[model samples]
Target: MDLIGAYSDDGAPSPSRSGDGTAALAVVSAAPEVRCGTCHARHFPLSSCISNGIYASSQVDASGYALVESKLVSQEDTKFFQGANTRMIRYNLPADQMHAPVQGPTHPSGRKADGGLSNHRTGHVEDSHLSSYAFDEQYNSFHSDGVAMDPSRPVAISLGPGVGAPPTQPQQKRQRTQQSKVAPAPVDLTQPFTLRTRQPWAEKAAFPEQELTEEHRAYLEKEEKAEKDAGSGKGETSIFHGKALEDYQGRSWLEAPRDLRDDSATSFLPKKHLHTWSGHTKGVNAIRFFPSTGHLLLSAGLDGKVKMWDVHNQRKCLRTYLGHTKGVRDAWFSNDGRKFVTTGYDKVIRLWDSETGAVLGKYGEGKMAYTVRFHPDDDKQNMLMAGMADKKILQMDTDTGDVVQSYDYHLGAVNTVTFIDEGRRFVSTSDDKTIRVWEFGIPVQIKYIADPAMHAISAVSVTPNKKWWCGQSMDNKIVTYSATDRVKPNTKKTFAGHNVAGYACEVSFSPDSRYVTSGDGEGKLFMWDWKTKKIARTIKAHEGVCIGSAWHPLETSRVATCGWDGLIKYWD
Candidate 1:
């Protein structure tokens, strides 16, 4: 049976050859003279050919109705099966090829005859033959970073360059110049300059200026009235939402003391093990210190949970936050550290209270979110950015779950998104083997680091000064690129001698931008001096692959690492 069309147990009659040679020739040779009336006319409806096959040669069926006959494959016409392998699938499909009727003249709505209303417009200019693309290979596509302003703008790269490929340098540079981002400039013109959203998912306003929905407005009004009636109870209210945590603790919530480690002790990392926080039952996936309080380290694990710890006290788990239905992939703290965001294979983004471990809100990403980061600026922000498995970088206002912006430039899964250079800009790494540099609010890429070999960048980091960008390759190496403006990445520096193969190992930069550190598939930590581009230390930090590593913001030497072995190790 064929893959299309319904057939009965006793199939309908098909063309066949009779035993008698002279009669068989006459039986199968009743070929109809296929002449198309519409193609000969000025219009041809694609719908009629596709649905009813009216334009093809037809013969009467058992019901005495015309049925467009399916064409048989001609071995000389085309190579229908060139290199097929039966080893992959259990069984082979029927080999005889079948095809639809040959292409007919198309009349896609705009080309009706003069009597119809479609052709009644007398003054409007009709689409000329010169306006249509004549090439058979031409296709439709958006620019990797933005919507193409011209509908017929041709892409340099062909279709299905999956995972990654280096962008054509000349084309990218030309588009960069032509589609310049126009910031508001004072001018003598009559109209003030206005900015618009460049991508469809992007909202025009930032978190603070965004218009509120009816549901959010009602929730805010109720929350505010309740706060006024309470009149300053045991715990303080959220400054942004005026809502208090349901599980608020008395007095010591925000005043919780920092870890007892002395921040003034060391300026350089001492390659030695200090302490291990080891209560998690499954592999630890991510680790980071709180932005507001640098002493508290936060970790998410394969156990579908998140834990906060005092880095100085190895055994004490400060708090356990639970909401995700699957293993937690990544977590990030807000600038104030009062709220944090977490994402996982579950595809849900959860905002949690840093102090009380309460799940405040959530937004469902359609695909698994690999990593998440809080916006660096503190101008009343609740924007949470995440790297999605769907090869896109997305930003959402956690307050209303309104998408602030989305970047669909990556050809593969987005693995990392990190803010660099005092948080004015950020970089995203993808399995597509490209690292893109983007400004905070700009909709297009400012810079790109593309490797020709399509080496998946599992993770990436940027220096504090934003002078350099680094990416972690599955080839067990860390590659560096210049992030300074007025430069394009044609050459990349490679740091070798680490084993990150088979693991999406996370990477980080020292607070001073002098050292680059990353974990390997072998559960060891690799730290390299950026200036010398040499390995400084390689220590066994975990029994399994270490996927997360972080350097303290306030302290230059203190570092934390977490791995699949379910241990969080601290070092200084």
Candidate 2:
């Protein structure tokens, strides 16, 4: 089965087919005609066609179909096929082959035309002019006429220099039409797809009934009332309305400054002052006041030194405790003010006698300890919770220095830990972008707060009165949460407007729970109106990262902050 040539209306082969078969060529026609030699079938209206002398002439039918055939030719064979060439040739004698001659008169009926086949040059069919209909017959077999085509014995036409060798087998063409890939039906995006054999499950678990008791409800109401009253003066401009406070970019605190500060007092005394007693060569990480006398302050620093300070005098290091092998990350005083605990990068928490600076006990083995805080109301029986760089929380018994429980709740290092209301519950924040509340007996998560900004929560503190809790984030915002039942638990209020990236290292509330104070990465101390969610006062508190802050337990007018600058600043 070989392709001789495509027939032209003028009975000549295309000029472009004269060169080597590999030369790129295009065939143009309104509707090219095709014939099959096998069945003497003719097909018409070819969409696209390529010619190769080695392959059979095949064309698409009216419905866009084509047939391809292949034959094994031997070098010894002379004639192309064993049969006579009559079947592959077409005669011009048939009226169907020609339209009326443009200007010629018809021959007299039954009489032979004067120009016989021998005398005619272009008008009559000669051996050279015979149309190869038999060759066209083999090309038409590729069509199916709206019927399924045989997959096993399919056909393809080979073009170019490789023509007439053998046609490639038809392949399953990729379904490129968009309609062919559509499903039988459309799916609804809003509906959950459920398998019939499976049971439906709740997406989120409900809060336990015990958590919403009458006592809890009453507390929430009281807290809510207090918060509302504090923000009521600003009406719709209030920022504490949602589960988390969002930035109101165009609105500046300066536009509403009076609403954030109390100008009633004539003295410049703050509600509390943090006296930094500096002896470490590096930044202080934690601070605690003596439980018996609020005048004594204890601080731990990255320089691996712990210092006790006398708040009454100029901020000076009164005593230094050296034991930890690495930087001290956290420090806390026992309830009786006679002892303190310090945790550090050395992976140990050491209990120390407050008066003599004696190492009482050592707990924690190989984990990098981040923070340590004592239970609020107990001296002998204290809860020491420490944050670990290994993404875990450890609760230890202060008396025995033994780990009581370990929590693997955070995905990243736990940065801060603080107890809520007498160590009955506690809150922890982490670089994993979540804050969690843990109750004493329950192992499961009680409340979880996620920040959409995904910033690490660097520090968390619960107010002394237990009315509110505040967390500082790496996103330069201070978030406040209400602890009382008068308001919704876990709701956050964000205070923005820090010129530099704020790493809220410490946060505390005034005794009245009216003002919130935070230390930033730049050693700036910002006091925010808890109710208004606006910055009340800004103090140049330190020269570097202000890592720790504490309020004067008795003096409600002063606060202190320690920083990387190896200095602690007192604000009033």
Candidate 3:
């Protein structure tokens, strides 16, 4: 019977036989090199001597064959024996010779033993692959010529010519040609040194100093120039430079129509367009009604101008306020209707004299103001709050033109700010997709709401009864939240069906709090039943993005809409 013993250097198990056909057992010994003291050798376990790369051999008795010393081969080299039908014959070496290459024995079938020629791509051991050529010129086959295998080299070997073939001629090393440096041209210290080069089509590539010709200067001097007070005549019909002080002081333009008396009555959705105001040269971004009376209308436009119209009289533009150097983003009137505030992309906020069209105060710190609001209570009218592009809500004293408080916690640009809970607290929304509630004079937030499903709220509107506030979300929906201290999101009352995404379309509530209305990016106006959250009406209001809407305080059926088409339309 054949008895399998242990693995050998060739990665196969060695076997031994006994004379009576009984299984043979292995004999273990320790090398003389491992000594305990003089004239004495320490005995070790079979595994200890093998682990230390030390071996010892003992003479075989008459009943058994001779035993050989063994060495360990890697697991990878052992796979070659399963199909090769090879027998293992172990040989020993000192522990210091482990990294050196050793020649493997040949098989009786005239085939060389596996010398680590592994098909790395397939990871299989090949049999009798005696041809030295491979598809690629590189070979990983290990040979014992006093050279060690380098594991750091790249493995791109394939079956191709010259894989392991010796070169017919020795290759010489290449030599690089040296370049000589030329001395640079000498530069004069008196003249300026310039690297500017001339172009093929021009005389010189550098620009020359500009000077006007004598004839050009003479022509400019002859042009007519207007005097500073040229058009100040009493009857000149100029809105900016003419006399119209008597009409403004009389307060005659502030009278409310008899029809817009009570705001407590139920409101109705506007059915038809009433009047179209087309004076703005660019897109109108915001519209507001004169405080409480709804007798006059105020509009801010991308044309960098604010204009008020006589809503109760001839419906003509009563005055034009021009101070912003860029698009005006938001405008609001003071409680008395005598002063107003305008904030714009120019990073300037100006308090204006509503009647005389004069700038009374300016507030800014070089950051664009996105929206502005006056403290709701009459006692705090001097306080103005503006949402800035730098993620800060700035509160300034309009009377002193000094910034008083700053709220700076939002992670993105602040978009809208609305006073809630009777002007004691305010709610703010930002591009960071968070709704924050803050106390009137506090710089820290009291409530914070952030959800993964929430989009940025571009504008916010409080209901007339002060119970709930709605935000115009960029996800094409208006989301509602309680206006009280809890400030909980009201999922059941969310009003949708209008596309307001990407545009800061303003949302508004009817004066009686019976309906909710908002403009959309498709130039359409939408109204929803406040309780049922159903769309009540959809009107085609403008030719471009309808961005802002306001329901008249007293007239239940009257609503004003402004859009990117640069027109403000009144619907009733």
Candidate 4:
């Protein structure tokens, strides 16, 4: 008998007990429960089903299929039901009993509908009517053996139509077993092994004799001709015949380019002994070569002495000019090769007649004259520019030693001053971390290279062609700036090698403009290839800080370096 009842988690209003003294499975009457299509089962607790808008069935029909009522099932489940082939169906109850719309069951709307109960008579099941309570029912039939079976279950019958029993599951298949055999140990093919009866290595057949083909005979003839020609000195010239002996003999004396060595291998060999010259009693702060005479060099020392030397002859002190009371910091010769100028800590700039070793004039009254230079081309109206420790650059007339104009923009000490050409346009580097371009004829400042990180530009030198300007910073970095575009100067490269952070006290470009040389705080002199921006060579030029370096004006590969060690080195 079909029984309908409600089940709840609280156990209220339990189902009726059957004759077998067991309660029947609850079928919620107030609200239906939703069933899974594949499992054909519904969730219990009709209160939750009512809240969820689903219902369960009390009895199964002839089709052994049931409906689950709910509008709350997801839209994906709706599509699943529409395309499903399983023996499961969904139903919609009367509108007044449903909380949501009756979207399934496909019943006609209004009075024109002719299926199920009429909506007008029962006041229910109308598409336009809203629902407040609704339910669905699930169905399952019992097999003849009294076990429940799903209508969707597939059955295979063996006998007569409608009367035969269904086939049972087949027995499990058995697994095959493999037999194990003992394998012989591997044979040593390199040695000999007798397999069956006779030893194959002990018996051998004779090789047949064969005649050479025409092609093979021709190859042999060609080889004999080549051998004869080689012996007679007519075959392709031997690569090892003539210069090989000389090349082998010179191998021990030749020096290879550093880059030719493997980067991972040792490329540098330390010198066993160092060569030193100490004619100057005090720190030699500046040194420069005579433009036309490469063998002559000029040096300025802290003793207020400017000495000329024959650098090629064991560094013999040639001439000494003493006038300044303080240390002589810089010295440079004129382009005409007639005179040179020296600036000192006494704040005096002295012009000297080089041939007579005589002092000519003294200019500027400021103390701490750090650097001095003459105009590149003009001899009569020679311009002497000097930077002071008080952050001012004084331009003077070399002929009279009279101050002409002053650049007063640097906030700190002006360390170096350099001219680009003979056009009165020059550049200066200061302790303020700024390099400025100033035109002599104009009153306005032309350009300013301000980089906060580029601190203490101690020395500045411009290439002869004015393509680049290079300088050394107190941060132990060599910086090069492109002068190709004046409006926006760009730093082309930076070279770093010094161990201590301080200015490169002096710097100069080689006469060919192919190399640049600079002296740094650890008494090291460095040569850099201008084009590659790489350090080409380095030497410990002094025992103390090397404060000055200069290239011979006329000798492309010759250079001079001086330092606090009171020593000067001439390199070629």
Candidate 5:
């Protein structure tokens, strides 16, 4: 079975034997002659010879058939076995010992007759050359990091009189010029790298002056005239569309609870869901309670609308104010609760009469306002400040609608502005990971707080006693800082549990300052004990990131939360 198509010189089927009298296997092919050791046969594909598990050399008869020996003597040849008792021969050949077949009249040395294994195209080879690399006993060198020793350069083995190692060619040295040592100029971080020259988000004319048609120009001019003269109420109106204005006129439906009037009462955690207000067409960004009274709730929405909800009565949106043309980022109520300010991505800060739903004044310097706050002092209610995307704290006079002063120090967009120390000074946070304190009406910064491990503070709230302030850090924690002159962070009071990363969720303090509550990116309301720094409760509050929560200023357990799902919830 080991032989295939073995034939004699007459072309009849017959097996053959080698000179050593061992049985041989033969194969027949029409290819040219091939020789290996003492065996010679016409060449066939190497795959056919090795298919039977034997790579034995073959001897060819005159009729072009190969007789392969059964017992191979060369250890480099392959052998076939049939049973457990059968003998096996194996070859272990190094890669370099293997040679490809030479085509034209190759000799036993595997060299062609004409080229003799030294052809220019095929490369020179000698019979004794089994490997490509040779070893040298006396000369060996290699390159390291520095200069390598050149073997071509001669060296003396012994130093005799007037004789030494040959000198190496001198290497050229690189010449370096000394840098100037003049003192560096001082840098003032209080100023921006360059003055702002243009505002891309600033409001512009409907069309360029040169391109405006007469009708379009006239209509725009008339609208502008009306808006300026207060004829259009600055594009704001009290018309409630389908609802009666009388319901909101005197806020008659709202009745402040008796217990809410006691300012000294301690706060309690809200345990039950009270109500949900679903009016915003997009995500709700921030929410606020009426100052002192907490009778009404205000919310700013990504839909570019501000809504006022009656807290004590209908628990519905009492009035909606439409002013900003883009998403509203923040909203704040004045000390008396009669006025409120709103800032938005439209690059405008708006002041509105809460009762009348009329926009009183609009102010902007072509920079997006991220947050706004009214002066806490009663007499300074007309003055307000805004944190701008341009990295500045802008103090504006609501009555005049003009920016009176700018506190410019932050290297990033300002996110929050809170007045502490009884309205004499204010603290601001920025994306630059800094908290800055400034004296009111002053253009200089009073204190600059920054740290290598600090995160950006998105929102901030001062405790009722004005003793501590907490910031909603983007790191998913509420970090506390002193409200005193030193303005140092209170590291021992970090409240962490819920995730708020990538969101500007606002944190709030309970009315009595015994607890802190914040909304998280997971739409859960998280409250932490002020003294223990442990979570009091976690309530599933919304369907999306709960961006802000507000504890009632007067009530012990009332809380309001708003989220990106476009709904606001009341919990008690």
Candidate 6:
């Protein structure tokens, strides 16, 4: 007798006693279970089966299969099959990989009146599947040879038709046990679910169809091992095993223009690191965009050179900038893509045409320019700002090779200077533990922001709307303050997790200002939600301290990171 229809030789309930009073062999059901046709993965999800009603059974009277009893299948079971809650979920349903519906016992409502397999477009068995449960004939009682519990066999179980002792109830197929008392509740797919139980199916045993022959099993295992060994290396391109089960060609996801396709337009959230650049021989300190409406990336290294790369194809360096006499500290692109600028410890600031990589002007006057930034205006090529090691903020008029504006208020080295409010005023942070906000071309500072928690602000960034500004403190914290209320310097929020630890860690906002991102001294990147002040992610990105990071100005998804390990990485 099968598991579901099991009966004693006398047509009584099973767990039959043998001569020595031990139970007889296990009752394995002859029922067929749903499974993936291609990969041979077992059991269709309740959602997949119920999308067409009850599960399509393979049993039928004309095929000599025993009729199923209607009393065994309660309405509760049918309801469970149609619910949204399920233990398994199919993430994607590619048309080419879709299995054809088995044309056997189907649900009444599931089948079309034409008597064909229901829902031919997708895949569903016919409604006659319910007809198998006629409840008219008493299923015949079949006997099996008793299972012999041999001490020589560890786990191997042998069963034959007719005669000896039964296996333990724990080992009985589909026999309900006290598993529910010790284990967590299974996801009852017919009910509304509240809690998430990840991978609940792993706790259950597989159906017989899930079992494979030795040869087929070995072949699949070998292919799986090979795919993992090859990984995404050696022209594999994708991390997925494209050689084996993934060979089925599906309909192209990219058919129409990007925006018109399935309404999933592009977004730039650094989901995964795509490529790494190790072109620099020394630590990389700066990274900037090539100012392209298309795609380009620029990075400056302590090796005393700057490299340009295609943003989409980052492995190959497109061009190299080589004028710095010493390690380059920073680089910036003009609002227009025509030119860009760089600064170095060699006491000079150099401007070059972006296209030919030719030096256009050398602007620092025997001062080690520590930081540089291009004017925000597209037409303001002559206007730019730089901080010198001499504790001076110098604004250069490249047109006349003169430092027309100078602000020498800070007692310590100026760490960073950035324009705000349409370049009408700018903010500067120094090693002296002060943040000075000043109007452009004015010699004296106008506003001073010094918070007790502002432990050595190493980097500062302004929100896109100029409503707020933030400082990355070396004391392993980032603090934000209101930009509009300069008198109060109203502390907005603070984010922590990454260890800056007295190093120059770069910080900035997402393009929409929803997030504040930073690089830490521990070679990691942290992103914080502005309102929640909670860290969204902490990414281990480099071997050494990560010094600089830049999110794409337009795309929310792409971010470039630089580290003291002399590597630049792009994540999207």
Which structure among the candidates has the greatest TM-score? 3
Writing each residue's lDDT as its tens digit, candidate 4 over 123-235 gives: 54444442343111111112342233232233332333444442233311211111113333445445544462223533222223479999999989976774454233342
Candidate 3, residue 351: CA error in Å?
A: 0.3
The clash numbers for all candidates, in the given order, read 1, 39, 5, 15, 0, 17
TM-score of each: 0.54, 0.54, 0.62, 0.50, 0.59, 0.52
**Per-residue C-alpha lDDT of model 1 across residues 6-33, encoded as one tens digit per residue:** 2234664222232222232243245434
Candidate 1: stretches off by over 4 Å? 1-262, 313-315, 421-424, 446-448, 487-493
After superposition, the stretches of candidate 2 with alpha carbons farther than 4 Å from their true spots are: 1-278, 313-316, 451-454, 485-492, 499-504
Worst 10 residues of 6 by lDDT: 233-242
lDDT of 5 at 558: 84
Stretches off by above 4 angstroms in model 6 are: 1-269, 292-294, 313-315, 451-453, 485-488
Residue range 1-572, candidate 2, lDDT tens digits: 01334444576544234554322222323345567543345533231233433233463343332222243444322232234334653322322122333235656673344334333545554343424673343444323222222222243443434344322344223443444465424333355663322135432222123558899899889766644532332111111111222236654211222223332322233644444455678877777766534566677888777877656544455567766656877787766776778887666777877655566677776677778777676542467777888988887886776778888878898888877755677788888888788886566667887747657777777766677777776777776667653223344577777633545477776656677777776767777776687788887777877666666665566677788888766666
> Rank order by lDDT, top first?
3, 5, 6, 1, 4, 2
Q: For residues 267-328, write the lDDT of model 5, one tens digit per residue.
A: 88888988999898999998988777888888899988898887876677778888666688
Error of 6 at 13 (Å): 99
Counting only residues 3 or more apart in sequence or on different chains, how many pairs clash (N, Cα, C under 3 Å) in candidate 2?
39
Clashes of 1: 1
Mind giving the per-residue lDDT tens digits that candidate 3 earns over 1-572? 23333444585433332332122223333233243222245543222333334443332234332222353444434432232344563432222233223445644564221333334555433343434554122343333122222332323332344343332233211111111133334434355554323224332314454798999787666432211111221111215422354464463444555576765587887888789988899999999998888889999999878988878767888778876656888999888888889887766787888767766777884678898999999999999999998999999997788889999999999999999998999999999999999999999999999999999999998888888988989888899899986899999988889988899999998888888989888999999998788899999999989999998877777999999999999999
Error of 3 at 541 (Å): 0.7
- Model 3 has how many clashing residue pairs? 5
Is candidate 2 or 3 superior in lDDT?
3
Tens-place lDDT digits, model 6, residues 1-572? 24434345576543323321122223222334556333344543221232223323332334333323332343322322323446663343322223323345546566353343345666553332323333221111112443433322233234554443454556664344544445655555465543444344443432223668999989889766644432322211111111232123642211111222221223335779888887889999988764533256778889778887655432567667676646888888887666788887766688877656677787874687878887787677689899888899998988888889899999888988978777777889898888888988889889987757566677887887688778888778887766674524544588888888878888877777777889888888888888888988888989889998887755666788999999998888
Q: What TM value does model 4 have?
A: 0.50
Report the lDDT of model 4 for residue 527.
75
Worst 10 residues of 4 by lDDT: 171-180
Worst ten in a row by lDDT for model 2: 233-242
